[model samples]
Target: MIEIKNLSHSFYVGKKGKEREIPVLNGISLEISQGEIASIFGKSGSGKSTLLNLISGFMKPGSGRILINGEDVTSFSEKQWAAFRLQNFGFIFQNFQLIPSLSTFDNVALPLVLEGVHASQRKLRVQEILQRVGLLEQANHFPNELSGGQQQRVSIARALILNPQIILADEPTGSLDSETEKEILNLIRELNRQQGITFFIITHDEEVAEISDKRFYLHDGALVNGGVSIEV
Candidate 1:
């Protein structure tokens, strides 16, 4: 459902007149099929996150093309990207990225609210997703009131609230304990199995990579090990 071709990106550092180019991704090409859980493993500065950002439309690649669900999104304008992302993508971050002031329900409902859904419909959708993530009881809680795992569940609920076709997770379990990590991973697997959602995860943990249908190793801004599917 996702494809990257000849993707490369660089950043410039130093003063205005005299700057140096630091390459982050180089000729990266990969494809992820619908309903598959794929992961990219890399150490710091390996460009794994950069690849995700480019695909996310948060940053543009210096040279390359990105296609999602047969639509070429490489040159999508900001407005177009916003609309497309709302319909097709959900994002999870290492930090959970939840607004501390919002209740779990509101946090999960934010996307629907942005899309202009009515209150009654948003209420049902948010409650359903929160229940699926096992956070219905915590709906009234604030971020600071919940445990790390619970907070991450809130993040997952928010992501799933939109019924996105693909979820881009970055170090999804980074803030949790080992047991909690396992729980989150299992939840991810369950969601994929039941809903046929494609998952593209960026993480450094071997345990996280273990759950993936396909694994890729990134090093020095390139794929050191081809993104090959593993026999399940």
Candidate 2:
């Protein structure tokens, strides 16, 4: 339930008065249906991550419109974006993004805490998600105490704790071993199949793109595969 139209973005480098524009995304347009698993494949500096950031409201596009569930979020203020993101989006990062000091349970419970949920309810929600991600036993452990795969599961649990409509994953399996990556990928597929949560993944790995219902190749700040391709 996301639509992007004529999306473009650029960054300026060099000194203030004599800056040069570096285009990152150019006229990008795409639609992701509800419950769809979509992946964007691109090498470094191809604007795949930029597209995700724009859609996630982390930054505004230079010239474009972004619609999520029929509402134009292109001009949302920081406050509005924060509220909307908490209500609508989940995020998983390559680095897992877990706090070393917080245990798995607390890490996964942070979102609910931010939303002001009561302790009892937060406990139940966090436990359920942690179990779903197969990390219940590791709940008491800190991020540094767990393996890489376990830490990523903690990240996934944190993302799922709020029951977000869409999960935006960036290089989700990047730091894991091959076997762990396969396990994580299968978990993602199962989550999509069973929960109907939409997934928008940005990855360079073909194996990661293989799990998506639709895959697109992005190059030189433009989508090179017509913005939609089933083939890997």
Candidate 3:
């Protein structure tokens, strides 16, 4: 389980010489189980991304503790977070974040390369993930050559390649058309059901929220209506 307790964060923004602390998340607490699919809905600047960053260990919270499976990770160092992320978390974003210069296969294999996996092993893993995402035929194609849905598929493949326990998605369907968005949602659901991977998705769309087992709304720096039931 992932447990967040009284988490609060703020940013200093203003003139270079004078800045004030602008609160983002204020006394937020939540929990996600091992294989649950949860969605947090928020408007722009609602601290949705900030929450994800803190949970993923990309940023430290100003207060409170983040516990994953009974381990406190709030105070982890950068090096520790790096190793931890590689072992436990995967990330997906609206922009896809694929390398334009590299082929789909190479893009998905980048994480394994960082882990010092051998070339042969990386190839096998990348191939398996690509096939799982239904993108094996496009492995040699560059990002620019694929459709938007296909590109997102590559991004999903890359995320799953590491076999992480949790997948953090920020507005995952923000750039897709309705049909493509449905396809992506179905893919996410299938993966979660089959692989038992947990998903913590942040979005503004009701469609995305409908697919979640638990739903949350972030308002005024606090999470409201968390774990509420929504008609799927």
Candidate 4:
């Protein structure tokens, strides 16, 4: 569903009024297919999130091409990029980044709200996704009213409520207890098949790689060729 070629990104640091180049992504390239669950694994400062941000068009690479569903997104204008992301991508973060003041239902409905979806239709979609995430009962609660795991479920509900073509999660299970982590992972697996949304996650968990169709191990901004292990 996505293709990246010759991607490289670097940040310039200003020290004593002098500029220094700090490279994060160095000539990396990779592809992900539709309906496949894949991962990018690496240590801290490995450029994994940089690659994800680049793909999301939130950040651009100094040099590279990013193709989503065969369209060149590298040069899309800001408005175009925003619309594209709303229609094509769902994002989940390590911290369950829900709006504390909004009810779970409202948080889940924010994406559609911004898109001008009517209240009735938005209710149906948000409720359905909340149910899928096992958070139907918690929908009326604010972010602080739920447990860590429950909050993450609401975040997942918010992300999936858009029914986007791709889901990008970064350290999804990092903050959960092992048992809760397993619960969240299983939800992701089930959602993958039932929704047919492409999954591209950056994780540090071994079991996550074991469950993926393909896995990429990144180091020092370069993709380790054939680095991601295939599902056995």
Candidate 5:
């Protein structure tokens, strides 16, 4: 579960010496329930990615509170945040973000190995997730050998390998062809339905929004429907 309060973030723009401050998020706030899929839609510079970064602790908000499972992430120390991210969060990026040198299986197993899972157990779990993402046969292949969709599937497997409570995906389907996009969407939707893995994905795609339990719009750094959306 996620709870955000009065969240705001900004960055500098213009020439370095004469830069101006531009706000990316302005008092945005919302809550995402366990097992829910939420999509954020916005224009090119509308701060959708910034909001995801804030939630993931990659970028700290200037002012606000972010709570995960009732733990206020704003209060986390550097090490604490690292631990929490490791144990509770999974990420899928538009680029797939795979390590160029690592084989698919190794990349998928990285998270579990980082958690100190035993080698045998990690191998089994990695294989299981790769199978889930339909990448079992590609296990020994390097990222460069895979197509865009396959690489993204491996990224999904890497994210799921840890079994994190929440998945944060930024344009997971952005780089694929329409048919491949459909495949990825169906995969993610089924994962959400069958495994109850909550997802908060930032996407410009309407089809992605349609699959979500609900949608939110971001513009000028504000969360649309935040105040008026009923609890039910």
Candidate 6:
């Protein structure tokens, strides 16, 4: 569950000696229910990723309140944010951000390792999630040996290995072919349906938006619907 109230963000642009605030989000307010699949569509530089970063604690909001499951996290310290993210959120990226050198098993085990999980337990958990993502047989393979879809599956397994309550995916299907994208999207939907994991996906793909339970578009740092059809 997520609750955002009157959220706003901006960045300083221009020369170092002379900068001005360039607002990205203005008075954003929205709530995402548990287990719901939600998509936010927007053009380039429309602040879609900004909102995700704000929610995930990658960057603090300039001004506003962000509550996860009823706890306000607006002022959380860096240490607190790190702990909270590890315990509550999983992240998937467009590029499938896996280490080129790490084997699939090791890649998926990174989170557990960071948490100081024992070797045996980490192996078991990694195996389980790899199997769930249909990557069990490729456990020992390196990123370079796998296809794009397979690589993305590895990323998905890594994210799901911790069983976090929410998954924040940015452009999840961006790099895959259309057919592969369909498979990945289906996998995401299946995971949401079977595991009840909430998905907050920011994507420019209409096909991705179609699979979501709720869809909204971002325009000039604000959310809008019913008038201009969201191309993204």
TM-scores of all candidate predictions against the true structure: 0.97, 0.97, 0.95, 0.95, 0.94, 0.95
Q: Rate the local accuracy (lDDT) of all candidates.
A: 0.92, 0.93, 0.91, 0.87, 0.89, 0.91
Show model 1 residue runs off by greater than 4 Å: 226-232
Candidate 3: regions farther than 4 A off: 15-18, 225-232
TM-score of 3: 0.95
lDDT, candidate 4, 27-67, per-residue tens: 87788899989898888889988988889988978998999
On a 0 to 100 scale, what is the lDDT of residue 106 in model 6?
94
lDDT of 2 at 26: 91
Q: List the residue pairs that clash in candidate 5.
A: none
lDDT of 2 by residue, 79-113 (tens): 99999999999999999999888999999999999
Q: Weakest 10 consecutive residues, lDDT, candidate 3?
A: 223-232
Least well predicted 10-residue stretch by lDDT in candidate 6: 223-232
The sequence of per-residue lDDT tens digits that candidate 5 reaches over residues 23-54 is 88999888889999988877878889999988
User: Candidate 5, residue 219: CA error in Å?
Assistant: 1.0
lDDT top scorer: 2
Task: State the local distance difference test value for candidate 1.
Answer: 0.92
108-162 per-residue lDDT for model 1 (tens digits): 9999999999999999999899889999999999999999999999999999988
Error of 4 at 140 (Å): 0.8
* lDDT over C-alpha atoms for residue 99 of model 5: 98
Q: Give the clash total for candidate 2.
A: 0
Top-TM-score structure, candidate number: 2
Distance (Å) between predicted and true CA of 76, model 4?
1.4
